[model samples]
Target: MHKRGQSFLGEVRDQIRSKEAKDFVSAELNHHLKAAKNKWIEKGMDETEAEEKAVVQMGSPITLGQKLNKLHRPKVDWLTVMLLVTTLGLGFLPILFMDADYYLQYNMDASSFSVQKVVFSLLGAVLAFCVMLVNYRRLESFGWLFYSIGVLILVLLQNSFDMINGVSILVIGPFTINSLSVMPFFLLAWASFFNHKKLKLWHLSLLFVCSFWLFVNTVNLPAIYIYTFMVFGLFLCSRFSRKIKWMITGGIMGSLLLLGFIVWPSLEMYQLVRLLAFVNPEQYAEGEGYMMLLLQDHISKAGWFGNALNSGTIPNVHTDFVFVGFTYYFGWLAACALFIVLALFIVRIIMIARNIHEPFGKLLLNGAVALYTVQLVSNVGMTFGLVPITTISLPFISYGLIPIVLNAFIVGVVLSVYRRKDLTSMRTFQPQQ
Candidate 1:
């Protein structure tokens, strides 16, 4: 090897041995270099030739380190986090002024955001653990069964159940599934993984058509529409029967047109107003455009660093407008950080989808990526007026405990995807059988 190559290799080796680097990152770095070297040697090159080719192919190791610097895997550093939480609690002085109502509604005393965060975090951890313990692939086996259960829960919620103690149990106690929260997984169960690939067009058509009809009673209409789009996206991913995709797409489109006709006369004036507002937001500024307009004002003033002290309050701050304080407090730096983190998560899912050994795994990950990406964009963009006002919350950052915990379940699923030892990892890229 050239002296330059030797020095670069030594630096990388030192990095691998240091505590600053993760095993996965270090391992992948080495794997890339080894791959480059193997390619040259496999071509019957001499040592110098192989070394030159390997070095060129692998890029400069220093540059590789710089590229990876920004992407260090997030660690759950509890000590730092706890200190941050303590500061946020004390800083509630400023925080309260911005979104005082949100804090007030939650009874923002000693245990407002902090205490609730603890509850939600623990809840998220438990749910994630349960999902982690189960065989994710096995989830495919009972796909339709799970789909039916999801529909049934949504039905019971809108039709029969009541939140007696402000809590409605999804499946009694042990497996309390929330209809609104579990929609992502339930939707994935049907559109992505049901054993309908070999089935005929009419079969797929019938199943989805009926699912939409039955689900509408409690499907959270916006979520249904979003999932419908995700279904089409996953259909494109599946190299399944072509007729199945066409039939299902045609059925959904046709059904939507028919439903629009049937429901138009009976639809509430408010719904029409909202739709009209979506068409022309500026025209309805005082009425339907209030949320969008106010949200923009708050975020704009948030500037680089968020509003000084407590002047940064935005309406619906905690739930819908949670980005308000974040912008003012952490400034654009924080806002940019959130967007980057979310993008990484979506990209990670897509990358994981590529690694799976089976079509079903690909299907699930694609559906999940769609769900995560769409909801994220809708939330942030709607807040900033890039889209119409949609009441979706940011997946991880929003204060809705149920969705927060649900998000943790998704994290676990992705981690489950990540840690699968049986899959074709970098060391052994056997073409899927």
Candidate 2:
């Protein structure tokens, strides 16, 4: 056989070696080539000529191997899949407890709440699957569109409804839209547009104005903080220099301070009380501080291994303070285990983000990470009374639909990026003529 023919076949073998049945594949390939060579020789071709024709007839070795690679590759990230399933499963325990003690404790409709939660969870899972199937890069093209829509939603939400307990929930027909909960995702997705680019002063001004627009409409102070923090984190990860990052950081902090100053006097008495309670929960124990004080009392009772699934101990245990309730019911051991699993989950995401070579994908993952990590820290802080109580639900482990759905979608995006990380450049692999 000619050396070129041997090299061509060898390249094919190496490329397809990832296949499970590589040995059989290589053997069959070899047998077919040998038979072809023999036929060509009998047709009066020389050895080298027969070998060259056989290799050409087989087409480009690179293209063939890459095609086989795609077919044989396991694109699903099992680790993420397992983590998602396990986290969601554990999250249901709190809902179960809520259902069991509903009539006895809160006097709310437990069955209805449970049904709604289940339905949303299923819907979120479906959305996640759909997100995973879509190419993540295309999402960048729609970034501006999503941002515009999110902005429009925020405007409608702000103008359409009166404040309910200081925050507005926009009800458009049957769907309850917490524009605050869902709007940041659009911004995060749109961040791909600004990554690693030098923006003119006007561009920066536009962003600041847009962010300010969202900030003013947001009724929740803690959410404003989270949003600001996320934007700052994204800026830090941007292609800006250290000096620019510091400047942006300083600017953001100043803006937040100014915003707070502007809004502080306008805050509802209850909102003011809640903020003040963060300073002295003991002082407001019976009023705005009730939830914080209750969480502490429950944690004290928790000890190491919690006293079974007792209900009514922690108010609103199905949502905001689910972590505290979970710990109170299941004990510190369970809480610790949950924390460890969640930490591992974030770490896994960070690892994938680090490995991804694409700028936009990495930025998207970073945004997701920042969002999740901040929420995690804030929720845990609020649970233990280290931070001001906010409506931020614990990711995956909290009993809320919008947040759960959003979180699931973020995970799906990360998985999509991971699956296609290697395929980005090979989408249309072709050998030189």
Candidate 3:
């Protein structure tokens, strides 16, 4: 309560450049002053004298603030940055050398596609950088807003969206937005919701049920899978009681089972055929399994150092099957190397998430990791015929403007969390009585 303590804290705050770090620094400094003052008071010193001595014991405010400033300064994970850049470069190779004949069949220009990819990549990089500079903590309070926006986007896509290759897309002028694009909004929203200290079990259940219904209505299987996995990941990292956590886990499992039993019969002929093909690709080779068989054949022919094979016949070679095409041209060794880089990129982010002390930041990173991991595993698994084929794109490597940009935004968020990991205190600073 002394003027001396207040003046010292003000001086300390002046040295801290980051506005986000200022509150934490001030709180911690005040806590220390209060504790020291209480100690002097216990020793029978006068109140004013104790406060003055406590302030003096903290040493020069300018020096202490400068030290704290250095510790709390924004950091960049250059190693992760390098790994991401390496993966992006490797991903561009297949697109750069895509077969022109394949584009002709779809009435598209190969040259323009490559050029567009280049533009998108640049835009994605810029977006990542821009997002990295933002304070992620500011998003914690906007959970409901983000959730509403995400649900609205999904509803629009579900009701009146243009159909492209059986996938719903909203075409706005020159840009086409897919259902998957709503993921980041939902991811951040769920992260905020899970980290909420006062969120009730009933309210959480309602939110999950509503989101699940919207996702199901969209019929984007990849988005559904990613969303489900993300929610589970967030729940596991949430600060809920063990009983509540288990209840939620059981509820999700039961819902999925019930949906499977009810939705299976209602699935369209093509959807049923796709599922059947996944179970027995050889039996449905002439229909939905044709692509699966072709992928296997190409992968088998792709040697450690390439097989000199033309990958023109592969469908969506530049997008979904880009990995197979890359393997055919650059060899399995190169593909594995690329995979290692991707894995390292993911691991680096996980490591950063582990070090973060802030609940919301950690949740955000975990949610992103969950979504990316599922997309990576599912996409690669399908390419290897280990999982059912879906429209999931390889993160960062997929040839789409929206996917790349959205992925970059997620990466930027991870960077933002890493930037301030040191600045966050483990517990809230409180002044000693």
The weakest ten consecutive residues by lDDT in model 2 span: 424-433
Q: List the residue pairs that clash in candidate 3.
A: none
TM-score, predicted candidate 1 vs. hidden true structure? 0.66
Instruction: Report how far residue 260 has shifted in candidate 1, in Å.
Output: 6.3
Assess candidate 3 and give its lDDT.
Answer: 0.82
Residue 301 deviation, candidate 1, in Å? 1.8
Between 1 and 2, whose lDDT is larger? 2
Q: Which residue ranges in model 1 land beyond 4 Å of their true spot?
A: 1-102, 105-112, 160-178, 184-188, 191-196, 241-268, 421-433
Q: What are the TM-scores, per candidate, against the unseen true structure? A: 0.66, 0.78, 0.91
For 285-404, candidate 2 gives per-residue lDDT tens digits of 889877778888888899798867465467678878889988887889999999888777789889998888788888888877877788789988888888877888888878767778
Q: What is each predicted model's overall lDDT from 0 to 1?
A: 0.61, 0.73, 0.82
The digit string of per-residue lDDT tens for model 3 on 1-433 reads 7898899899999999988789878877787888889999999999999999888888888988898899888898788677667766765787554666777876788678778888888888888888888888898999999999998888888875445666667778988877788888998899999888788867887998888888787767787888888888888888888998898789878987999999998999998888899888899989988989999988888889985555446788778887887777778998898777777767887898878878999999988888778878888899898988888888788788877887788788888888878886624433323
Query: Candidate 3: which stretches are off by over 4 Å?
Result: 34-48, 258-271, 308-311, 426-433
lDDT of 3 at 350: 88
lDDT of 1 at 90: 29
Q: Candidate 2, 163: how far from true, in Å?
A: 4.2
